[model samples]
Target: MLPRLNLRTSFQLAYRARFGWLATGSLVALLSTALLSAQFSGRQPATVALDTGLSVLRLLLSLVLVLMTQELLSREFDRRYFLNTLSYPHPRHSLLLGRFAAVAILTLGLLLLLAVALALLAWLIGQGYAQATPVALGSQYLVTIAFIGVDLLLLTAVASLLAVVASTPSFVLLGTFGFMLVARSFGAIVELLTRNTAVVTDAENYRSGIGLLGYLLPDLGALDVRMIALYGRMELLPADWPWLLLSCLVYTVGLLAMAVWALQRKHFA
Candidate 1:
């Protein structure tokens, strides 16, 4: 239907405009970082390489998601190119959802490519050295990558929502990253405050305030499973996976719903 066609067109446009260079640059950066980290770290080279690669991959994917949102959504609106599409008989929410779907697919595709490259690089790095704690290249690594994808999709949902509500493309990029920083850091901040009550006199009040913010924001930090991939520590993952998956799903769907509602009411002049 219209959603399918819109998805195809949006994806094709994004592929042609951004995907090629972005993918190439991202792969190069990921592999280069892994190699350098492996070279520099005498002990546990593979673990360091994998850890650095995952961090770099997360950053690169976030940049890709934000840039794609800016180009595909905000820029289209800014240049009035979206007007022609909005004039179609299809519902506004369909168009918005279709475009968001394109972003999701493209981001996931990039994540997969970079993840494969990182895994290969990690394996190659491990082959030369036998460390005390070997890197987990099997299911654990795959699970880590899957969770990272979930995190990026959540970010994409944030971008999609901001794209609809914000006035400028810059705001969409800024707002998305800002939301990410807060979501990722708030949990750690609360935990640090909880552990070191002496660090702040009003720790209880501060914890309560941050706890309030936690309810509004997705706990992105909870989704980080790099340690499991790097060290094969599965002690906490079994109990945490279901809750993490559910929280991500709920937040993503809720954000997309809000985006659709906003797009439906948008007065595109």
Candidate 2:
């Protein structure tokens, strides 16, 4: 079923699949960030620019992931169109895997385009102000943006999984939104716990619970290195990039497998 998945057709469908709104949304986010940076009358224009740009990018991408997956999956399931598709010779897993690929490809393209636009906007804003610090266009900055793309990819996989298992679009949306918030804040939550010396009730157990959570949830904070780019602090990124990449890959694969399993057992009665 996986081998039979048509990549080209899926890519085309994804390109044409309600993508206009996503593109428009991304443009709005970009313009808003640029305008906010332009209006700021404070120190460190570069920091403000990068922070605003990245925050907008993350927000838009998160919406894209959740909404795209919900539309693609829920439209078929909710409307019972998936039954018609299953009437064909192809297996059910093909539909699930193919749609996921399509969404992933579309997401990657959107992320790259938005990242470039934001980078350019940041640069232009920096050039406009003589005293303001300009956003660095270094390799680290580009890499940081790439990491954000990876983060979106991981989140997309999770959203896809939820779309398959969830009963309705609203359920999928809420699950994905909650997952995004938890994943983004888990690192900070763990850090806060580590510093809370007042918790003298079984410190070892608390440490164990923190370690377990650290292993389970995605470390979205690790992928966020915008400060490194804004401040030209390359050392801020983890020393082992490969480890982070590996973790994301593992999580994506796990999510996809679960989505496929969920679809396999899904009844269309």
Model number with the top TM-score? 1
Range of the 10 consecutive residues with the lowest summed lDDT in candidate 2 = 1-10
Cα lDDT of model 1 overall? 0.89
Number of the predicted model whose lDDT against the real structure is largest: 1
C-alpha lDDT score of every prediction, in listed order:
0.89, 0.77
Model 2 per-residue lDDT tens digits across residues 112-198? 888777777777767767643455678978889889888888888888888887778888788887888878887766676678846
TM-score of the candidate numbered 2?
0.87
- TM-scores for candidates 1 onward, in order: 0.96, 0.87
Query: How do the residues 137-192 of candidate 1 rate in per-residue lDDT, one tens digit apiece?
Result: 89898889899999999999999999999999999888998999898889889999
| Clash pairs for candidate 1 | none
